[model samples]
Target: MADRPEVEISYDLERIDFERTSELIRASYWGEKRTDAINRRAFDHSACAAAFIDGQQVGFARAMTDYACFAYLCDVIVWPDKRGAGIGKKLVQAMLDHPDLAGIPAFSLRTSDAHSFYEAFGFEVSRDGMYMRFVR
Candidate 1:
């Protein structure tokens, strides 16, 4: 396990500013055009957590949940410069600890990399689970 950074974990800055968050995500990822959609989901879900370094959003992880037994962690990314420094883990931990997200029977995510990183939080592969995205 990587050592945690000295940054503070928070759920307040989550999706607060779409323009800013969108820019951060776009810069971190390989130029995906989904800010409007991301904003819509973030606002619609109304339950997310973010990690900030000195009040600046360096990492973000969000979850959509029924406050019961299901939750999906989505759009988890940390700034490129912040990668490999434990910020992502901190952000994820913060989201899982959010008052609206805690105690869910299951929390899930899909990632192309960072399997070991996510596994640090006890996330494991489901032998029979598969995700199908309907883009209509």
Candidate 2:
């Protein structure tokens, strides 16, 4: 692991800028080209964390949680230029440490490429049968 930069992790919705977050997401293959309204609604329903350097938003992660039993982390992203700078890890730690998710029995997320990253935080691939259906 590399030394983390002096980045501030914020859970404040006011500190989240939709355009900036969407830009970071849009750059990734797992991200959809979503409109601001759509993104705003998603954030509205989720617990979100963002990383900033000199007050500039550089990374973000969010989770939809009942704050009791389940949390599904989604849309985790770090700006392309800032990848590998430890911002993503810190952003995730902030989300998991959020008061809303404390004592939750289950937390899960989907990732195609960052398995090891999440594993470092104690996430594991499910061994039991799991299922999903997309309403397309």
Candidate with the greatest lDDT versus the true structure: 2
Model 2 CA deviation exceeding 4 Å by range: 1-4, 127-136
Query: Each model's TM-score?
Result: 0.76, 0.85
Per-model clash counts, in order, read 0, 0
Clashing pairs in 1: none
lDDT of each: 0.67, 0.79
Candidate 1, residues 1-136: lDDT per residue as tens digits? 7665577776664335566666776665433766667666664665666667776767777776788877777778777788878787777778777887677768776666656667778787555443311110
- How many clashes does the backbone of model 1 have? 0
C-alpha RMSD values across all candidates:
5.5, 5.0
118 Cα displacement, candidate 2 (Å): 0.6
For model 1, the stretches where C-alpha displacement exceeds 4 angstroms are 1-5, 13-17, 27-31, 128-136
